[model samples]
Target: MQRDQGVPQPRLLHIEADYSPAVSKTEPWVDLRSIRIDEYLQARSLAVKTQKAYRQDLQHFLRWTDKAWSAVTARQIAQFKTHLVRKEEGQRVLSDATVKRILGTMKAFYGWLWRCGYVDRDPTIEVQLPKLAEPEADNLSDEQVEKILAAVAGTKLCDRNLALFAVLQHGIRAEAATLLNVGDFDGQRLWVRQDKGGSKGVVPLDEEGVQKIQAYLGWRMSQGEVLLPESPLFVSASRRNRGARIGYDTIDKLVCQLRDITGIDFHAHQFRHTYATNLVLDGMNPYHVMTLTRHKSVQSFRRYTKAADQQAAEAAFYETKRRKRKTEPGSEQ
Candidate 1:
């Protein structure tokens, strides 16, 4: 297969000492896998975490194959699927969903190789992967959101923590939130310079979220923290990583802290789910919700709608009972 004309070729990155296209394909296949994976990844604008995940998944496939690339066929792909699901003593039995993801990675890998003219046939093409169940978005109610906000309202680092929560509440992922810069906030909105799924744009902040972020920046200035365009929006206050760009670990730790204090069984991602759910419940257009959530695919946006539909059905049932009780004989109008 000749390289597609419109496909934007990505610059080579992370080349290893042992990686050379000139190296014979008959050698250990790791070199070939790494080179091809790098090329495959660089061709598209995937998130850092996404790219890393692809690398890991593809590497696992390469190791499992344990043979020359050209020799793999649909039968080997099926065998690999069995290897993932078997409950043998040493074999790590994966859930159907996980196995499905791995198989997806395999299809994507071979598909790319075929498109890039690295492979003649895609062994994963005919092999079937399990159909996944509809994903349910977590429900973090409005009251819970208020409780989370109020929990930090009196703290000394109130501005800082509130700013972080504001960003999360507005639907920014923890990793992307951590990657924000001081100048990313424009008083009215946040510029999500980097986003998952290659969908980067400005995420409009609610008035309260904007105020919290502005106050946080103001508080930093009061503490003699020099604010610069390039400064990390959130800095670590921990002794080890103090004044450095906040890490995703810190985001997790903060959620853990809040979970302990408020007795809320939630994690960082629940905020995003809540954000999307709230939008859906409020009758926002799906396209508008997708824009707000920065979802590039309708499939991704549909998860919240599924949960919202269930919630609406339950709400209507309760509402019907309430109306019937109100109109009962001798009941108050």
Candidate 2:
């Protein structure tokens, strides 16, 4: 309290200060602090998978730098690259692609800090990047795909497996697949949530895919599972995990089971590659494929396109050789 004009007066409370009125007992305001790497990540409107990957990569960089963000230098950045490439017990700790990815994470993180005025400069601006090989898009052959479908058809959870396979056939990422709720689909279209830097769009569903999903839903109802708008489209079939939506690891195990049964070694991502390759080989417009695949850039879409071209060229070359051999005398049919 203060005396003003010979009258007692209550002191003015500064709004920005930590003090609050005692009468109401309201919650305190958010405590503002200095910028942090985690704060940068939280501010970013990145996809869940991208945010997770970037966080893991930044954590590795932080472990190496062993100092505050502002204290890091370009020299330390180079050293971090060397550290990533260094061998541990006669094996390289990180692959070339992984090293590049780590550098990318650093570039993004430091760039953010610089923009936020927390750092004087981006140390990663001049850091040399590892020369990475062109990514190879591995996909399954038609015969192998047929084998997987056949095995799933013969499985005990036939309806569930069929639905999963239909989803995989569309090249949907496992995370996006798991995030799918019952209302994410209509009879003919699927509303996909965005993946890493991907666009969210309604993709057309094949009749077979829709049918399999409906069959699985019907089976779930028969098993006393509640079918609601917010319910998971795909649920765990195991007793321990029953009625809960399948996770990425569980989906991985499901694909592994297919591999074991059919002796075809492949992962969920390979199915995506297969689907993209099929689109390219079938002469779908590149832009259309990019839109359907939700790829943000043509560069990513081209990886599948390039792979398809190589496969087509090899097929044509073998056909030419076959014709030449048949034209020659005494060639077997």
Pick by lDDT: which candidate is best?
A: 1
**Tens-place lDDT digits, model 1, residues 1-333:** 799999998997885586556855675534665777788899988988999988877776777866666678889999988887888677667888888888899898888888877879988988888888878788788898888888767555678889999999988999899999999988899899887776687899889898889998888888899999999999977788888999888878778778887898888888999998888878887688888888887886788898668878999999999999999999999
Error of 1 at 201 (Å): 1.8
Positional deviation of residue 175's Cα in model 1 after best superposition, in angstroms: 0.9
Q: Record all residue pairs in model 2 with backbone atoms less than 3 Å apart, i.e. clashing.
A: none
lDDT of 1 at 24: 50
Candidate 1 displacement at residue 149 in angstroms: 2.6
What are the runs in model 1 whose C-alpha is more than 4 Å off? 1-31, 89-92, 154-156, 310-333
Q: Local error of candidate 1 at 155, Å?
A: 5.3
For each candidate in turn, the TM-score is 0.80, 0.79
